[model samples]
Target: MVSVSRYGREMGSVFDLLGTHEPALTAALGWALGRSPELMSRFLNRLGLNGSSDVSDVAVQLETADEAGRTDIELFTSTAHVIIEAKQGWIVPGEVQLTAYAPRLDAAATSGLDTRLVTLSDSTAAWAHEVLPAEVSGVAVIHWSWDDVRDLIAEARSKVRGTERLWLDQLEDYMGAATSKRPVTDALAYCVVISNDLFGDATFRDYVVNQRVYFHPVTGGGWPTVPPNFLAFRWDNAVRQVNRVVDYEIVAHLSERFPSVADDHSAGSRPPGDAHVVYRLGPDIPLPDGGIPSGKQNLRAQRFWVLLDQLLTQPTVIEAREATKELGAT
Candidate 1:
């Protein structure tokens, strides 16, 4: 009998083993999509398409022309036809690449069929959102991140059983691992500035002084190196008495940008660099009731050094945010 362990040893997954054979991945996705109507509905919803939960028919890698091109994954019914273009990793298809498939998609949308085009990526494609809508002639273009797909599968898992459920679980695990590996070089760190009347907001300054937290921004390039899922904080020049060195693992990467309304105390926007990654702070190190211990010596880097040393010994700190939560709950 064919077993997963035997195959997994040679390749990270059956999907990886298939490599550039888009047809195989298409077939796999098609099967999964058909089996889970909720998955199909959520997918269609992301593409801004209206569809019933019931999926009637699905096709894989349909070739429209020998050398021309093919649709990666096609879902069809009496009313709708969705042409999906999927990317595995960092490679993003340009408007020209997607434009090539427009003809095939248009031709398929006959007999009053509502046509939609979708591009799937492992991460958000800001450029695709900007370009694909205008470039693809007749069809409506939408983008879906791998995380969106994984969430759909996870939601559908509860409704499946037997080997189907096992397969869904495995696919979710594979996608999670693959997407997490995407490198994030630049991030916007949110910190608290504890200085006297810096921004002329006396009320805000009082709050910061009381809570012992202030809002500060740090760029990835400014630091020696930014380890993934970590927040590195720097104090403003005005703040002479505060921790000079401290960092915490980022928990939730919030969609909100830095220098937000609350950041009026901050000098300006994050320094020019790559895209600014935003995050919510993780758990802070246990502090005394008085906070950070009093005195000029308390501001030394050694204080933070000792805290980080202890944090590094914890396995949860090294893992992803979700995994860290699971460890804590146990």
Candidate 2:
């Protein structure tokens, strides 16, 4: 039987297991996108990637080696010099490994270089950020605290929440005026909310953009119960949208409406199957049927007159200047 957890999106970090010494050290991560070894390693594992001899670690090697000893990293990058430092505990990476190793690595390379230090302790990390100078100890220092790491993770989700909320407000205004003329009491019909309008009809083009969209299973009732599906979008190909996280509140409401309507599509651009109605919310783009919907398509030019009139006549430059002056005086 298909399961519930099947709907979950994979959660990962840039760091993976660094070691038992500190939390950040042994984590998995994909890119040195300036994350700890542990976080970076975890990111890599989530995507199923790892070190191969074919890949270049110039960034890796130049930061790992010490001056006095011949290190594997220095030899591996095949450069004249290498400087990479790994440290743990209250020993202080900035004071000891990074500070000591950076110079040696810088000297080995005809080019300027520095090692990266990834550590576990929050206190040490705080010290690194507050005390460490920009280019000392032969390397450029980047430190991550437990608080920093937690905030980053929280920010990822928070961004989605913020975007969804903002767009929801815009969507309400958009649907009311954009398609209010249509008959909601009539048979079931769908509405597509967009962020920007990017479509044209032979001689004319219109763009009605909205950041959020409200989806409903059964379309017309006097102020129909708020639609269930909400997909937040970020542009990818300038044409396609990505990142569809189903909110728990949204999902809970949806479950109430569609007890059997839930079926998970594969992550990313995979098409939704067995879906009753589909609505996209993202940047402005042209729909297959042109920018105008069924009811208002023919009256678009006339409707444009209505919206345009509201914009031009509602307030003039004189009023704007008066308001501005009044505000400045206050």
Candidate 3:
């Protein structure tokens, strides 16, 4: 005999109810875009939409086709025609999907009008930007992640008041949860060390010594080295503050033996000079306000790690060009 379960009947979230229906999601987003100028500004900014224009004139869910293929959202002004294709979850919209909308955009384009294609998804739609036929469509393709939208809503929430503020607050909360649950690729884990005397320094200095000693170990053994991507901070004991923050690229990891200067340096019967891990760091890039506060250091790191990682991952476009020229010289 099978017993029927009766506990799973509750209605889920508003977004959950919307499910995979792109049209419905488009409508919900369009409504938000219609009401919030700040949201519209950010959305347009992500598409690389430039110059001074009336965001109030922006329209959404404009019917560019009647027979099953229509652009999801369109913002048309005197200067530009921006089309957005939005997707929910990890289900990516393919190039074929975008190409279908090209003819409509082509027909809509007028002389001197800047046409652009944009793909919005819960996760980074980098593939869409890569595959979309920008040359054929005669439009630039840009991808905006839901995280970008959340940031806009957060910005809007700060400046709005009364009913608008309340609605934006709710929307921001919803998007925050939605984006948080989306599966991330190359997700990073962070560990921060906060101490009154990280390097026994109370003031900013050019460099600091990090010492490591080992006991009952092989002669070749040494302290574990930090990754090139790791960050280190100096906390001041007297002021109960963080004096500096440094972003280091581990150029070299060197070790050598040092004679024991004090009894504390020795381990049991073993004399000093066991091992050392010298982390040669890169130049310092000081964060605002001297350094991140000890109380809020973790939060600050968590917030900026992604952006910092992207910077560290590759050289800038200008840098790349310079490197290419230097390579040719060799």
Candidate 4:
């Protein structure tokens, strides 16, 4: 009954009408994988199928029926043929279904193609790997979870641009919602870079230290669709204040909050009628002596999320960033 409004239309999604519908979700992923070679490569590599050649002229087939059963998705590249059996829940594909797909894979292998059968399910990778046989009828079987695909898309984002980037974003959003899997963005803390001019200004520091609120324009693509719980203020080569985000709202202008302050620039250059995201914060937690140093690494001006524990425990920003690589690895 729920839906995500995207591309200007309200349509059923995997979280709603298609929640347990295998073909629809399978087709959605197949479409994106067929279009983006980088995504395909990353996905195969994540499954430890690194020996397979890069995707070239890949084709995706959905619900192709044979005597045994209907396959959820079928992928073909010049050098390989991959059969995917997708399930919305943790259940493994029945022997009947596996038997249906194995021979087709064997025929492809006989034709001098790298044949593989992949199971995309809601179960943990460890469970699927343990129960599912490594090979079926001479073709390799790889187990993967929706969570794994979501993370792969997040990683592949850096390797793509333009339409490919947009496709990956949409795919990631859908998969995250469908599986009720919160992306890494939700697990981390958001860090904002305070400009030098504002960092040195007493009024700005006072408002943050005393008043305890931080805000930024909600117009940029840099902001996350879902906000994180903690916020860190970075300036003067260190993270000075780290606070829990109590609430956030969009306001029309600076005068709405600070009516008496004559300098409007303190709240930032608020274009008339523009909305900003104002984050209400709790008391700042004391950081280690000298605060968390930025060290030699140059962080971009845009806001980014960092593992909260890493940001607090690691001595330098670069080290904290390095620690974040281990996030979700387990």
**Among all candidates shown, the one with the greatest lDDT:** 4
Please write out the lDDT profile of model 3 over residues 112-146, one tens digit for every residue: 66777777764334334333455445666676666
lDDT of 1 by residue, 19-52 (tens): 4244555555665676556667667666655654
lDDT string, candidate 4, 56-159, tens digits = 76677888987877898887777778888987645556556676789888767888987878887655554466457888777777887777787788888988
Query: Can you list the residue pairs that collide in candidate 3?
Result: none
Q: Give Cα distance to truth, residue 222, candidate 3, Å.
A: 47
Model 2: CA > 4 A from native: 1-19, 22-24, 30-91, 107-109, 112-120, 124-134, 152-330
Candidate 4 off by > 4 Å: 1-20, 47-53, 180-330
What RMSD does each model have against the real structure? 10.3, 22.4, 19.5, 20.1
For all candidates in order, the CA lDDT equals 0.47, 0.29, 0.46, 0.69
Question: How high is the lDDT of residue 135 in model 2?
Answer: 58
What's the candidate order when arranged by decreasing TM-score? Answer: 1, 4, 3, 2
Q: Give one clash count per candidate, in the order shown.
A: 5, 55, 0, 0
lDDT of 2 by residue, 114-148 (tens): 23333323333433554455556544445544344
| Two-way TM-score contest, 3 vs 4, winner | 4
Deviating ranges (above 4 Å) for candidate 3 = 1-21, 62-64, 123-130, 133-136, 176-330
**What TM-score quantifies how close candidate 2 is to the native fold?**
0.25
In angstroms, the error of model 3 at 132 is 4.0
